[model samples]
Target: MESIQPLIDKAHELIQRADQLQSKEPSVRSVPKLSKRIKAELNFLHTLQSGDVELKENQLQSTNLTHLEAVLSAAESLPGVSDIFSAKHATDEKGNQKTLVIDVIANHGAIWVKVTARRGHALYRVWQGEGDYGDKDIVEQALEYNNFASSNPVKFIVPKVHVMFLKGLPSEVKGELESVGIATHGHVLSNTDDHRIDVPCFDWSVLKELKVIHAGDPRRNRVNLDVSTMIAMTSNLTHNGCWFDYPECLLINDQAIEERHHPQLTALYDILKGKQLFACSTAITIYKDIVGNVAGPMEQARAKMLLTKVRIVDDCVSKRTQELGWSNKIKERPKIIFGTGDALEMVTVSANGSFIRSASKHNITYAVDLHQSRAFTERKEAQAVTIKKDDAFKRINLEQILRDLLNPS
Candidate 1:
């Protein structure tokens, strides 16, 4: 196998050049473009290094990065593979542009090899002349590549994501590819294990900052839990053997204050239904102030229907709480709970920095602003130290927050 270490070294040098160009003339628009290209090439170089291929400079076009990664991964796993060629479209005698039928060609002794990256489950339709692989059948395309090579070609189909080969590709499709003399490489995962590992879906590092923010002056610093963020946090808690104690009252945005048919109510109901995260609660308090303020008959009816639905759900969840093993946790008293009250009251109470008790005897913790806004590096009521919905979903640490909330000493 040929090594691309020298090319990887060259790519690093190009990155330095691009950086120098940007530093010398930051105002030049083309310098940023050059830097972007160099960055992409550097990523490609790192990908190829993972594949362990001896690559040539001719194989390094930015456009062919995906196809080349697939081919290199296949080459690294397959035996007796040597002298790989990156094929391009060639004109027929008619002078019309011809389609590039094969992405890569490899010589395994006297046999001609063609490699393709089967991106998704659409290959079956593509091969049968029914989809985007064009009007020509994939078998016919393989024959065309063979005709161009002037020899019969051995075909190899590798999945774009190596693990996808195991479950994503249907058995029928694998059989069809093999029936036509095209080898499907599903076992390439072992060779590319380092590259096939799953990446974290959420960034959890933000939790440390969130903990500090939430701990600040419990009254003034409030963390607002939006529907989706609440869902994620509750789901994480459930996974970690904890559950959210049903809130005293479900408080939504100021929109709910005006509109009886606000979508946030429906969203919260759906989250509760889907996850069954809130349990072991007697009943939810629908604030008379909020519900009684509905402007019209239709709005009143919607509010009534929502309350009815939530009550039914709560009753069902309360019954199953013991069976679900949340009874003990429920008895521990919910350290962190979510609800909304008058915005002015929340600000006033926080400003006073006083812990107040409700009729239910739950102590008031600091308030969190779940409304959409940028995070404040400096604590300011104007910036509000709010947790944006985007940041809550994108960044990590809800699990730790749950732990601290449940076991606060």
Candidate 2:
């Protein structure tokens, strides 16, 4: 393309020359420049063959990372088609449930997935996009058609998204998140004392107005508490700007509608009390587990809760055993896990009730606890037990918990 530079300059010169001669009829005076302009136009046309003037373009909107692969698998697995948009059912749940809502826009709207399928079953199915398919269109289809029993390979269509949350955000990983843009005070942490909030904090008042009420001597090395405050306030999910919580296995669903019998939106809201959407439904549970580091997959399956088996292979703690009792009516069966941190550290938890409930902080009370229980088997012995003295007891206990959860001897 650069090779055409001289030609382009000559074209510009000829265009000006032609303009000068326009008032007069074509004559010997204008012949040379007119010929040059025509030749320049011809050259410009030829350059198109090799591609010319690569226009400055922003990145094309890409698929949402979490759902793109799954949707592609569904599309290719079907008889025909390569791209699709659809929602897949979550494997963790039983019965007719919808796991994700995808909107694929390609090839004249190829296929629309109303429900996500798992283990030959389906759930939480809905249509997402320009059409108004009503509420239970897909759900009824799942019940009436029984796509599960069909021999035909069910095709799915899932769209992709380009936006994401701000937490766990990598520095080099670029994004256009507004809240992230607002909290451009401090980029790193220097002793978290500057920001006093929980591990996954969500407070943003300081940065909302982009003001600083507190004062400190100008210190380049000092932590920006205001920025820290905004980061803390960032929600698990955001609409436009303000962030909100995405409850367990759910997105930031709205429950404001009124319905007498089946408040479908409410039901969706109930399922996702404290969670948000990032990817498709196929791997939501897995994504949740890895990020929260709550517990292993097998643990979640066996215990019917997020469970960890922290081992006590190495020497551990004193001759003390404790039991924690926690209950929440909001749950049909509460989350459970076993981890390294004792009831004290609150870091390691069996069933990881903390992460599940805390994924998006809830006002409802949770009673999980650790209470010591004394026994009559106490002995007045000469030798002291070494398990109680080891500092690695936490690590050991975490291993034992996993073993117990996995092997369960």
Best prediction by lDDT: 1
| Model 2 TM-score (2 dp) | 0.14
For model 1, the superposed segments whose C-alpha errors exceed 4 Å read 1-64, 86-107, 128-138, 149-170, 187-409
The clash number for model 1 is 14
How well is each residue in 1-409 modelled by candidate 1, as lDDT tens digits? 1445665666566556546644653542344444455567667777766767665555664344344344333333433333334343445787765645333333232233454444333444555456753443444555565455432221111111111142133355556556644444342322222233542222222211211112233333222232223322222121211112212222322222222222222233332222212211322332223335422343334334333322122222112222222233233122212223222112211111111222113312233222211110111122222232221122223333433332222
Can you give the TM-score per candidate against the true fold? Answer: 0.24, 0.14
Global lDDT of each candidate:
0.33, 0.26
For model 2 the local lDDT of residue 193 reads 42
- Model 1 residue 249 lDDT score: 20
> Model 1's lDDT to the true fold?
0.33
Q: Best candidate, TM-score-wise? A: 1
